[model samples]
Target: MSTINCFFNTYQRRLEDLEKKLNRDQLLVADELTSAERELAMEMVHMGLLENIAQRVFVTKQFPINDFLLRQLVLGQGVYTGNTALYLWHLSDAFPYTIQLAVRMGYQVPKQRYLEWTENVQFKQVRQPRLEEDVKKIDVAKTTRKILVYSPERVLVELIKSTETDKELLKAGIQRYLRSPQRNLNQLLMVSKRLKAEKKVQFIMETLL
Candidate 1:
């Protein structure tokens, strides 16, 4: 078969596998699979078709994927690193407990917005971030430096507004974030000044003991 034919076959297998796993009542990836299963699975990943797709599959799976790999998987990857694992390990946060994935800008939001990119998903509904939204970008250093996604000032301001109207729910979410293993307070404060809610921040600051 041609390389193009192999590529099509790869996606055909992937879609089938993904759908099968999603339909399962209780999934246990390691129960029925071993290292051999992973290699075969990787071979069918359309490796030559799209460079990113193969890399994403390998990095996301860590080991080989079988009939059990769920729709949402990834933590040991280089970009996300160990922060997520640390938080989960310590039960420090509620996020990443569920499916959590960030989409690259100028990309369309997917049907499975909380998981992987399925289609045209540019912005996340939960975040609703924008280039024109006066967001402060920060350079997060890792193996090499790269800009990480954030809305800094706007997101906090939005949360504060939500707190006034729905204090119970808003507080719960922010508190949950705070309880997480990794949170940048300095980033939060910097964002605070850029917000239009100076009075709101001041009120909270004054009330804090």
Candidate 2:
């Protein structure tokens, strides 16, 4: 017996219940459904274009998407990068770090973006994600999420500012980010202008350079 078997196997089903009611009382389902029956049901749903509306795909994890679908998803969502990511962290003091726009790439993400997020998010397109990726399709919470761009260094800087605000924390952050591969010296300098981090920035730039 399979999940979709009951749908095709039984005959005494209320049309309204079958169509509108999705609860257990929806129909007199069969004991089980065969793989063929399951596939057949999927095809019917797919052909009728009822998958999105009727069959909900609760994705919070990564999945595959061809290039065409990728473009369609990205363009449709109006996803952008830079300030979006920092916004997610709730820290926007620094100049934004633009890397990539938010879109689908059939990317495999470890975690999806959070729903009801404070700001729109963008991600960096890289090779390995966490390490860096051009596309991030994560299942954030209960929804399937995606981040097409990212800036590791900047993200690190913001995270460091959250819990540990001690001078030592900032100092350590400065030292660590000084030579970080993704560390944007230019952005850091720009942020230093408003934050009055000239001395700190200069010192780090000098050391890293």
Candidate 3:
């Protein structure tokens, strides 16, 4: 079968799974599903094949999809990462208009193709599995929906690698994260060491604190 045909078939299966499993006529929240289940549901929502009920909240097709729905879909093997994840963790003052996501390197779709399909979201693909503690499911205060996000420590590791290119934004992001109580020194140190950013991480941690 053609790739497009297979893609649509997969989508149809996901839609069927959603209808059979979710069964609710009301707004859907993140707490209701296991991470695996949520991933499946989010793929359909991101594709514009399923309409979301509210910002980051998916409901059945009975509801009309708003433009804002495009910003809320962080689906298909992707996890919120970098500055965007920091923002979701409430460590940054600025709320992003375009969502940033990280997917596994093995993800089938070209990352740029996602932008072509939906301009409100962006994707980055990484090799290897992420540390479990590096990701979390947190509530979206505005819409009462839950979404996946990277921990502050993990976000810092990502930012450190980008410092040469985005120095000002990296400095600002670190400062913002430091100001928040959510910053975990132990985890940050550990992750930084693992990612070979220990020196910079230590400098920022000590200088900022």
Best-matching candidate per TM-score:
3
Off by over 4 Å in 2: 1-57, 60-164, 194-196, 203-209
**RMSD (Å) of each candidate, 1 decimal:** 12.5, 14.0, 10.1
lDDT for each residue of candidate 2 in 20-43, tens digit (9 for 90 to 100) = 322332111221334443444455
Model 1 lDDT per residue over 1-209, tens place: 99999988886776677435424412223323445544544553446321123223332223233211223222111111122222322323443333223433444443443344333222333334433344222332211122233343344455575443345544444555555554455555656766566677556645541
Q: Which structure is stronger by TM-score: 1 or 2? A: 1
Top candidate on lDDT is 3
Local distance difference test values of all predictions, in order: 0.39, 0.38, 0.64
User: What is the Å distance of residue 41 in model 3 from its true position?
Assistant: 14
lDDT of 3 by residue, 1-209 (tens): 99999988886786676666545433454556657557876776888655544334566565433333333353334677776776666666677677677767665654354444346566676777653447777754334444667777888787876743356666777877777677678888898888888998787777767
TM-score for every candidate vs. truth?
0.36, 0.27, 0.59
Report how far residue 10 has shifted in candidate 3, in Å: 27
Superior by TM-score: candidate 1 or candidate 3: 3
What are the clash counts of all predictions, listed in order?
A: 9, 20, 0
